[model samples]
Structures are given as structure tokens and as C-alpha cells.
Target: MREEELSPGEPAPRAREPVFLLPGSVSALAIILVLIQFASTMVLNPDGQNMLLYWFAFQPLRIVASLTDPSLALPLLWTPFTHAFLHGGWEHVLINVAWLVIFATPVARRYGTVGMLSLFLVSAAAGAAFFAATTLLEGVYLVGASGGIAGLTGAAIRFIFQPVLVAHHPETGERLVLGRRLASLREVFANPSSRYFTIVWLVLNAAVPLMPAVIGAQLGVAWQAHLGGFIAGFLLVPLFERRLA
Candidate 1:
């Protein structure tokens, strides 16, 4: 469960909040995604857009085929990272970006710019790897930032629910929130809120593949990629985070 603590003291001078609270790295990444989508939709011709997707979007069949045909090796080198910048539509991109901001903000605040980007890139690649493994020989293309955002969501779960430590200044009696302690794996499961959130997230992804039958419409959701990214983020965040004393 999440807990907030405030030290007992007089209020300190208030600082003005900036108009744009998002970190520079997050803004840069979002702008790149938006620009790519804009170019795909408005700047590029039909053939050009198709070529862009063909070369950049992750294709399971391509990886499997590349095992024997070395000519396909070129795309295998980059598609895992590139696929994240491509999206099926504006709606898909917008939704992914919105989620990215929510989950990534905390990660960026805790892990800094490099760590944040590292988690995103590594998770995106993990997602591609999982998708390729599960969908071998299937002619399908995967694109978008869902995998990376899922990773951030999982990583955020590691510490977001922890209690914040607040200490008051002995001299001026200024309220200070010292820091947040990262939850251990055991503690995460032991905590009811985090445990239930994890369960719900897993259930939602598992149900994605069955959406077509339930709603009588095909909604392409790469649940495998999401799962892979989530696992990677949840397990690998400690590598990016600083140890608390």
C-alpha cells in the first residue's frame, strides 16, 4: 500500500510549478513518436509509407526466415528498436503516448534520463523477442510503444507504493520528505495494493487475444510483447536504480 508522510513544521517558500512538468527526455521521445506518425500519415506517399513499415515494423516471419536466408539479416538488426516508433494509427499512438507519460514520469524522476531511456529500449527489444518467439512462421507485423510503456508500468510498481520518509529540519522546522524506499520482491507481493494491481494487469493482457471473439471485431494487441516487457522492467529496474541506505 502507498503511504504519504509530512514532517511537522512551518511551510517553506512555494516555488512556481512549470507549465511543462514532463522531463526533457520524455518530451524528446514523445516528439519523435509524434513526428514519425505525422510523417507516415501526411508527408509520405502510399508506397513510401508501406516501405517504411515493411523495413521498420517487427515481423516474426522475417526473423524466422532470416535463419536460412542471410539477406534478411539486415532488418533483424534494427527492427526490434525501430518498431516502437511506428504505429498502426493516430489513435494507437496517442493512447500509447498518454500511458507513456503517466508511467514514465515516475521512472524518469527516479532513474534519470539515461536510465529511463535504457529501460524503455531494453523493454521494447524484449517485447519484440517475445513476439517473435511466440508467433514464429506467422505473417504479422508489430509496431508501437505499448511494449516500452508496459515496462515502465511494471517498473513503477516496484516503488510507487512504498512509504515516503519525511524528516523535519531541526533548526527551521521545515517539512521535508526524505525519500522513498524501493520495495523488495517479497514486500511487493505482501502488499495488497501492489499485488492486486499486478494481477489485474496480467489478466487484462491475457484477455486481449480473446477480444476478437468477445466483441466480434479484430483488435490487434500484442499481449506477448507486453508481458515480456513488463517482466523485463519489473526485474531489471534494480539495475538502473540507486541503492537506498
Candidate 2:
């Protein structure tokens, strides 16, 4: 009945395409972040560096001060989204880039470029909001892409562990499928991979706040922002995911 039945002598076909590298959007984002950080650190003067942070970094004190003074409100509004693009140092950006490539690839494939962008913006804002709500410290400047990275990680868990449905190709007998279903929070935890990841992530977050004294270094982990971004990504991914046919 199938066309392959009449072509038994023909050579077998290849399997479905696999992504061996980072997608365009994710790669571009990483490059842009690295370039900006490079420019800020190497090319810019001390004043320029301060100016960039003043204009872009999310500052909780400024947001609160803006309540009484209207002029500071613009930075407050934009800083939440802008801060995700900036980083503290080389190590900060590299770690974020790694996480972004790993988790964002699947999200980008499933949700498309626009969806990924939206997720980044919303999650970044949520991360900033959570940090502001929890921290009593004034003049705190939050910078880096970790919130967005955590977001992608959270979003990926929605469907990454599910068993993909496969069908045999008529010509080559290669297996293929449309996509996997989005799993609920409970279902996600039931899977071993997701369960372990969630537990470890929580443990790390809880432990990070105590690392400064233990390590004898000033390590501002911003665990609150990470938690906020993760929660936002986990809850909001369903809205961004395309409906399966």
C-alpha cells in the first residue's frame, strides 16, 4: 500500500535530523552577552562601567526610591529585563552561557524564537522582583543571566524526561515522532531525572546564601532570584508551549 513497498531494492533512508550544536538565537544571545561584557571590562573606563550598571543593573534601592521620586522609575522598569544581559565576570558569563545552550536549545526548538525571548524577559523580571522582595540590603545591584538560565532549565523539565513517541519510517524504518506532552509539576517530579535535578537545585539554593562566610569570600549568589526564575519558568512554560497536533 505504501510507496516504499514498490521500492524494496532502494537503499535505506537516513534518520531524523539531530541538532549537534547551539541554535542560532541562543548562540547569538551568548555572543552578545560575551561581547558586551568584554567591552565593558576592557574598553570602557571606570566611569563608563559605573554608568552601565547605573542604567542597566537591577537596583532594589532605586526601585524603592522611585516611589517617592518619579524620574528614577524608567530605570526601575527597564533594569529588570536589562540586568540579565550583563554579567559580573568571565566565570559568571561562561557558566550562564553553558546553561543557556544546554537547556535553551530544547526550549527554542519547541517554543520557537519569539517564545524563548518572552520566557527570558518574563523570567528575568520575576527574578528581579523576587530579589527585591526578599533582600533588605540597600543599593544592591543585580547583574547576570543566571535567572534566565535557571528559567530555561525549569522550562525544559516540563517535557524533557517524557518518553518520546516514535513511528517507523515507511522507507528506512527510522523512528520519528511529532513531540512529547507537557508534564505537570507533580508528573515532572515523578521522573527520576527531574526529581533529582529539582532536589539538587533546591539544596544548592538553600546552601548558597551561607557560602560567603564558609568560603571567606563575598559570593553573592542571588539564590532568591534563581528560585523566582525557576518558579516562573516552571509555571509559565505551558503558556509558551505549542499545542500538539
Candidate 3:
């Protein structure tokens, strides 16, 4: 567990593994969400569980109302946990899983196992809060992990943008070492193809909601969820590191 730093002057400690299977907690959550949605099909058909009613639609007043009186606000507050696990359809799940798997796993690895778990829970909560407070004000209901995923994005950006700090591992007393931190954000998308991939990601997020509104079709992107979660993740990343060994 010794994490001795090898860098002459580099700040952040690098992760040990090339692939962070567990870091991308989103993958598991994504699968779970799909499964939950699938299970719901057995009891409540997709059409029955309308996104407006069944999903964790973030509505601040409603959340407060629920806290004040659960009987009345049950619909609004209760879905926060279950909502992330539900989706509109296969295409919807696939898209979310794609972004989550591609971007989130690496982020998780940097944070480590416990850090990854924090990303899932905290980001999810953040997305729920943001949606409930903002979109709910507009009487719109939102469900999904986009907000939480956004936290992952923010966390990744922080890793890219901020100063790296290293410390000793607590249990094994591993010193901070090289190959721990993903070196640079710029390095990730240095490839022309990766640049396009990043662009596509940004564009898709912006476009998801727009398509449904403008085209009169259902696009159930839940972009608010992504934004909220990302913001939460951005904050939690440092906090999590502090707790790490």
C-alpha cells in the first residue's frame, strides 16, 4: 500500500491500473437502472410510469413539501433513488451507458474504489437536488443520472485543470507514486478522433432536449440530471481524495 511518489515535481499521484473496471460505477448503475426499468415493465408498463409522474422529477417545493408532509409529496421526493435506474427505452439507456462507460470509468479509477462509489451516490443526489430546485420551479419534472454524470465530468475536468496533491496511503502506508493520476486532460483528447468524440459528447447533451422540444418527439435526455451530478462530482472529488489513504 506504499504510494511513494516518483515524480520529480509533478503534483498528483497516479492510479495503478491501466483499466479501472470498478471506477466507472456508472456502468453498474447504468445496468441497474436498465434492470430496474426492465423490472418495472413487469408491474408498471413504460407508458404507465410516465416520466412526469414516476421518475425522480426534481421539484424543490415538492421536496420540501415531502419533507414536511410525506403523504402529500410522496410522488416528488420518493423517486430520487429509483429514478436514476429508470429510463424511457432501450435507446435512452444505451446512450447514457455509452457516455457513462466511456468518460466515467477513467474518472472513477483516478478517485479509486470508494471514490467511485461516492461519485454515484453524491452525483445522483446532486442531480436530484438541482432538478428539484431549478426545473421543478418551472413545473418540469426530471429523472435520470445525467446530473450525476455531469459531476463525473466536472471531476474529470478538475483532475485536468487543478493542481495535483499527493499523500500517503493509510492502511498499507503506500506513498504517492507515478502512474497514479491521469497525466493531462489535453493528453486524453490529443488524438484528432478523441477531439471529435468530445465534441460529439457536448453536442449530444445540448441537442437531446432540443430535439424533443423542436421536433415534437420524445427525447427524454434528462440533461439536468447530468448537470447536477457533474457539479456534485466536481465538489466531491476533492473531498473524497481527502478521505482516501
Cα RMSDs, all models:
7.4, 5.4, 10.2
Please, what is the whole-model Cα lDDT of each candidate in the order they appear? 0.89, 0.86, 0.62
Give the best candidate by lDDT: 1
**Candidate 3, after superposition: displacement of residue 155 in Å?**
1.1
Model 1 off-target regions past 4 Å?
1-16, 167-176
Model 3 C-alpha lDDT per residue in residues 1-245, reported as the tens digit of each score: 86675677787755687663544455566677677667656667657666435445444556555666887576654566555655556776677777777667767666665776677667877788756654554655555556656767767755443335667777988877433343234744564544454567557765766786688998655666666676576556766653333
Error of 3 at 99 (Å): 1.4
User: Tens digits of per-residue lDDT for model 2 on 20-124?
Assistant: 567789888889999999999999999999999999999988766777998987898799999999999999999998889999899998898888878888888
State residue 64's C-alpha deviation in candidate 2, in Å.
2.1
